[model samples]
Target: MADSVTADPAAPSATRPTGDPLLVLSGVNKHFGSLHVLRDIDLTVHRGEVVVVIGPSGSGKSTLCRTINRLETIDSGTITIDGEPIPAEGRALARLRADVGMVFQSFNLFAHKTVLENVTLGQVKAKKVKPAQARTTAMELLERVGVANQAEKYPAQLSGGQQQRVAIARALAMKPKALLFDEPTSALDPEMINEVLDVMVGLARDGMTMVVVTHEMGFARRAAQRVVFMDAGQVVEEADPETFFTAPRSERARDFLSKILTH
Candidate 1:
């Protein structure tokens, strides 16, 4: 059976989570050559809220997540984290990235570095922390994500799930206020997906504001406070999980869910 993501007292919705907006995207548009990838996108993720973005392939879900950390630039619109617009380039952009962590579909670990090294490098280099202090924080995060025992091994020595957990640990080492996940489980083996999802679930329970782009309906339905459906680069619907899963208001969302749930 697949892993379940059911709400409990610790879930965002259960607590009626609301707070200062952490990430805001307004009138966001992006074009790759003649292809319009993102169109008039408007979305917000508040502190301690989990907003899951679900859509079919090529619907701009991944691009939207990437834009939050400025990994992908936009042709128009405004994106702000903690109410400040992202800087074009420089130390400001780097600091902005440090403030918002991102995990991609691929593990993206350094092949040459040990798991511990990978987690601590950013803190030591970017945050100007001492090596010992960085390692301490890295170990805590590694332990938090259930991968501390794998710290001495290089990325290639660990299983895919272990590597991904380490990636999550690396992100958390930055102490980012919000995290973005783009298809976090898409590249995982069937058995490994749950381990990563378990880590994510714990983060949600601990009040980590998150924006996730994924097709994992169970996680979205059970973990997210709101679900946003996108199609052809436009947001088609947004609703609480129960309503979105049972009685989606938009035809596009209904059609999309029908195709997804039937399989």
Candidate 2:
């Protein structure tokens, strides 16, 4: 199930100095029986780049993010990460997942474990990091996310913003090369969204390679180097923030922006 589809035969390996791209999706198609969730998805993300994806519901935004980690299988086409083609299952897939950290809308934390323990588990299990070393790393990441004070608290005891920060720290503890956020702020209350966004803004400031699927136009404008607009399982437009927001070229993109910004 490992395959690659490069834009050019002489193209360099994705994620290499050959300038191929950090990630590439070519003619990527996903189907659940007859329902096509993604169609002919062609995209390239380079190192140290942030790309924001936006689309209407069912436009395959979340599905596309999940596909990067093989959380969902593609029925056709290929996806490459750092020049490595994603395998269907087993050790190679596990390694790929480890290299790519994902943050979900729901703060997927262990409610029963302390925040420190939640962050430590993955490092200990997946990375085989020593307990003491893992704890030190976890604390540093927690501090980075501005949640070091909440390390002893359980998810149930923390506010939504705090919980999400902890989740971000946990993801960073894995030292992933790239982070995928599937609507990271979608589940937060209006007042709490900024806190999470602030942490993400800091990450962007540090030049983390990130792909965020969010409708937060403000964050997209402020943080993303490229904004990709998808419609009907296809990318209708791709542009910088200023161009995408002020002068989108596609009719669907303009319409989508009008509706979202109006409200």
Candidate 3:
């Protein structure tokens, strides 16, 4: 919901600052037919920490992000958010999703709804907030995202970047505990990419806990407190941004960096 969610709607369940595990994945595994997309994944994302996951395409980074919210279920392993394992199904799972906001590679906005309605719908429908209150919050978010002027327009009428911003505003309307991004900028035109990345950077700076899967090294290097490198469906390296970018300890990481940096 942050265009500049400088003002949080609610505090973390507990302020871990840099240690409390807001999201934990243990021995997480998944498969798509014969393809093992995730393999014994174990990771922890602390409260208010931003972790960026980077890897070549088909490395299962996107699948890993999807598993957090149960959009893609795992064959084995455990994932917990805010100290609670994700609900198996029904209203409980829905409620858990409300707590974990997600932004996708494609701007998954309601194409039929106006930008304002798109942003406010989740708050009113899922959370049962009054329409007026939801609208006020929606407008505030849209304004902060720099798309308030286009609030009345349909998704088709706005540029790709604007639609994505509206999608972010919609996610923020829920005031989730953590946000997951699955290559959010991959679909945008080159010129429109930064507008969305800038919004993400602002969210990180404002203490939003986020787990991002992206190929944008600059964004990862600049915003992430830790960088995770995934390869062949496994986490091969995890390090601070500087260590990852400059003195990578893993040969796999160094090769990956060489390939990425040579471009």
For TM-score, the strongest prediction is: 1
lDDT by residue (149-255, candidate 1, tens digit) is: 98899999998888889999999999999999999999999999999999998999899999999888789876898888888888777777777788776777778
Q: Tens digits of per-residue lDDT for model 3 on 1-263?
A: 11111112133421124758899999999999999999998888998899999888888999999999999999999999999999888999999999999999998899789999999999998999999999999999999899999988999999999988988989999999999999999999999999999999999999999999998888987788887888889887777777678877677777788998895
Off by over 4 Å in 3: 1-19
**How many clashing pairs does model 2 include?**
0
Off by over 4 Å in 2: 1-20
Pairs with backbone N, CA or C atoms under 3 Å apart (clashes), candidate 2:
none
Cα error, residue 36 of model 2, in Å, equals 1.0
lDDT of 2 by residue, 33-54 (tens): 7888898998888777788999
Residue pairs in steric clash, candidate 3?
Answer: 1-172
Which ranking of candidates, highest TM-score first? Answer: 1, 3, 2
Off by over 4 Å in 1: 1-17
Count steric clashes of candidate 3: 1
In order of appearance, the predictions have TM-scores of: 0.93, 0.91, 0.92
